[model samples]
Target: MTTSTHEKRPNILLITVDQMRYDCLSLLGHPVIETPNLDELARTGVRFDHAYSATPTCVPARAAIFTGQKQTSHGRVGYQDRVPWNYDKTLPGELAKSGYHTQCVGKMHVYPARSLLGFHNVILHDGYLHHNRNKHSVPMQEHFNEVDDYLPWLRAQVPGADLLDLGLDCNASTVARPWALPEHLHPTNWTVSQSIDFLRRRDPSKPFFLWMSFVRPHSPLDPPQAYFDLYKDADFPDPVIGDWAMKEDPQGSGLNPVTSKGLVPKRRLRNAMAAYYALITHIDHQIGRFLQVLEEYGERNNTIIMFTSDHGELMGDHHLFRKTLPYEGSTHIPFIVNDPGDCLGLDKGNVVSEIIELRDIMPSLLEAASTEIPDTVEGNSIWDLARTNGKALERPWREYLHGEHAQGMDSTQWITDGWEKYIWYSQTGEEQFFNLAEDPGELHNLMDSPQAQERIHYWRSVLIQELEGREEGYVQDGRLVVGRKPVNILAHLRSNE
Candidate 1:
């Protein structure tokens, strides 16, 4: 086969699904949710089982991805609004610089509401963001409605269609229900529709970088009625309960009784899980259609498709509702890299167990384009390890990745080695450790166990050193301080370094 330059410099398709759990995909071995398209992609690609969202929330996690920096360097350790995402170099910007036509077709929680952030074109749809609608958002501009693209298109479709009509909160992770609108109007379908249209009108001369970011399986938990009915009657396993969860379990989902956390009826919990699973399956189907459109355009065989998520969903685990926790359910995310044989080829069907963070995405994709990764990137390209041609390669990066999310008393910090995970409740200074190899569900808390004493001490010492430069008083005089607020960003820490 004669190699063509187009085959060598393949088009990049980066697909990100919102709030998807690592284990929920059928490819990843979840028993209930059938995500055939995603599973097929995994079968043909390298699946990184240990990939994570370091900060484990929408905004902060994406900052790590788009900038190739950890939460600390990116100055978004946890979720915050209008934090000025003024990165000097961004993933899309860098790709655009390298002659790739970059386009984003879904959720981009970038501040300023309309900031391009380097993408040449962005068909934005960020579900429902409360912060951007605030008066203080996009500071100095001062208008309340930041004007999102989706709602207007939706209103155009239904004349007076309102996504919030059925009282759905996009941030509510513990919620689930059937979509009141037609399936065609669903956000998942709309995103794919826009991507298909972009494909039909895309400039064919350049190798494109497309981000089909799906904002589903996140919330409103609203799947189409047909998708919702697929699992509404199914049985489900009990939520994973840790020994210490009883004290911290939430009573309800925010203020709504219709959806909530804590000890709820098993039937109601199953229904929520069913809807969540159904949303994923729905997205997976749309992905299949998008791939078909790519095939029609003769782009599928030559494109390098990378699928991941911003963070993950807690989905009733430990009586927890959403992300912003250090639990595996919240931080662990799906990462699949489908490098076509004609493209920048990598090992096929490789299940890499090495700990990989979301920060690695920028460098990896740049490497895929045969472009230079900026020296400022904190993560090295995984492509180096992956190009072993069908063999699993365990190249050394960080021995463990540090992650944290701010939630007042529920604020957390943790480090994981894919084998073992150590979590610290930053506020209370309480700790929990799990041998993730044996307990993937995180049901056991080994904090008090004598067997884990040495490991606990080791990780604790690491955290102490890690927090030394924090301005939040999390550490005081070389000791981990209890009851201190876990501040999201230490803006001055960079200058001190």
Candidate 2:
């Protein structure tokens, strides 16, 4: 197979789905949800079953994905925390410098709502909706204040849309539902339209790097009516680790404090799961539409498409509502890569079970574009996995993938090597271990089991070493400081209203 010079330089299409889980797709043998588009992408590309986020929160995972650095290295450790944008180099910025036309559409979640970082063109979609919830203010309040001129239009669309009646909140259960408005008006659809518009009108002279970020299945779980209907009668399976909390891992457990709330009724859990599935299916349809447009413009074959999420959502797993848990429910995310040449060494329908992280994406993209990856990046390039004649890569590439959640004093570190997994909780000084090969559901904690003591000690020592080797970038008064600005809690409160 002779490759042309133009073929060697592939256009990059990176699709990021917010709050999607590792097993949410139909291609992954998910029993209930129908994600034909994503499944199709997997069939034609490569599906990574063991891919994980460096940190399971939004901002930090995205920073890691873009910068090819760990959360500590990038200093964006928590949600809504101010990211150190000026300090690090980003993938789009590096690609743009290499002459690729970099474009971003939809949510990047950079602070101040408009940090371009590196993209040459950006279209903001779904501005800080749920993230607006602060102690004193919320995002809706900010929207109302800044978007008063657009309020009249918003009110006209839904006669009482602006009305804040706390009573209305109680009428609905936690089940996923269709948006009260038309699909075109929904934020996810709106973002997809903007991305389509950009792709349609984009200049073709330069190889392009486009980031299509979809915000859905995130929170306030809402999809359009048609999508909701798709799963109305579907019999959804229960979560593997249902309402069962494990012993806290001493290194740090990612389990949020809120998950301990009692199990939601079975029916309610089913409804919520169904709604979540519906939203995923809806996003899959939109992705299909986007791919159709790519084919329409003769760019499908030339574009190296990458689909992934910043982090996985709990979605009722372990009775958790949102992300931040170190469990597979929060850390593992769906990752698919389709190189331009269709030359990825793995079989067309192959599923790579080796563990990989979100940080690896930047270097992989650079390699696909035939651009040089910067030496500063901590991620390894997966170019060998995508090459036509490349060999299979080895596992435990970095010994263990580490995760950090430092919002509060409670911290967590997760170390996994596919079969046996260990989690350490710094705040409580507890350790949790699971024999994933025996109990993939993580129902049993073997941290104190005499039989697994040696494995536990090995992982604990590994975690300590990894932490010790980390560079203390910023320090103030004997504390390691990244110089992050305090988040405006009032701004979030105002947005909620």
Candidate 3:
């Protein structure tokens, strides 16, 4: 492929889904979920097989996306609400500064509920955030009715309609149901519908940066009746349970509806899988709708579309349900970039195996727009890797990535170099090592294997060095410390602005 030149900067469309697993796409050989639209999009550009969210939670992962910084730079290592998003630079904000009309159509998941974080305007719906929904916060703009643009829009479509009308808990892993409302009223459809409206009304004089973020395949497990029917009878594969997991929670899914780790009953798990797969297919079709609009509007070829997720839902992998785990089911996410106009001449249909993280999105997109990347941004642009099919790079690439979450189950610190991964529990000092090249499902623990001891020590030292000099005292005298209390936001980020 050769670079193609254009008189004007290409429009950027970033499509983000919540808690979508890397293995869920049929393009990547997923047996159940069908994502024809996403697969088609991938064929137009490049797909990354090893993309990850360092923190693997909504708040922290999104912080990395917006700020283009790692957990250390952004000061958010875990899921927390109400922390002000005061980053000096953001992806959408930077694009707006560079003369693009930027708008976000769905979930921001930021503090203050209404913080724009650099987009010129945002049509927000941050799912069911408990922090903003609490009674004390209701009087403020944090309330859903005040800050969620979707709520008002939904109400206008159908009087007295509420997202919670079905009474499903937002985080319930075992829950599954068909949406009670009309299919068009679903949040997935609304995101694309509103995005098309934005494209229609956008200022034609300048290029646009539209973020069509979807808040589905996350929870409530409620797909429209039609989508649910598509998968209700399909047989689904059982969750991969590591031998280590059974030792920890022998009771399994029997523990609770939302238990993070357990052997959930087959019936409930199957129902949840059906609903989850249905939600994904629905989103895929909605994306198809938006792409069609972009094409009909004569902007499809000139628009660059990138799709990814903040993190992956475990969905019973290793008996885990939600995110915040260092396992592949939680951290690994889908990342596909489609520059339909060949703006950067990216290798279409290329699947890059190099490890990339959420923070890389900012720098990559900014580079795509020919905008200056902020000096504070820690992630490197993935353009060269994508263009060269991960074989060559104009600049040096990271040999390994260090990731962490302040808390999940005793907090986690992990490192990976695409082919292998190492995880350490900060509080308990327990460790897990997986050769991803051999065991992508992570069904085996190599920590106790004598042959893996030396390699494990090398990875452990790397993590120790990465955590060295942190305020939390994660490392001392070149060794990882145990029992160090973790903070959701680091001291530097807490004091920053």
Greater TM-score among 2 and 3 belongs to 3
TM-score (all chains, Cα) for each model: 0.93, 0.83, 0.96
Find the candidate with the highest TM-score and give its number.
Answer: 3
**lDDT (tens digit, per residue) of candidate 3 on 14-60:** 99999999988888777788999999988778999989999999999
Considering TM-score, which of the candidate structures 1 and 2 is the better prediction for this target?
1
Model 1 poorest 10 in a row by lDDT: 251-260
lDDT of 1 at 379: 87
Q: What TM-score does prediction 1 earn? A: 0.93
List residue ranges in candidate 3 displaced over 4 A.
Answer: 1-7, 137-139, 247-255
Residues forming the 10-long window of minimal summed lDDT in candidate 3: 1-10
lDDT of 1: 0.81
lDDT tens digits, residue span 206-301, model 1: 788999998888888788999989888776767787776764436443334333346655565677788898999999999999998899888887
Ranking by TM-score, best first?
3, 1, 2
Question: Please, what are the lDDT tens digits per residue for candidate 2 over residues 447-471?
Answer: 6689999998888776766666343
The Cα local distance difference test for each model comes to: 0.81, 0.69, 0.87
Q: How many residue pairs clash in each candidate?
A: 1, 29, 5
lDDT of 3 at 229: 94
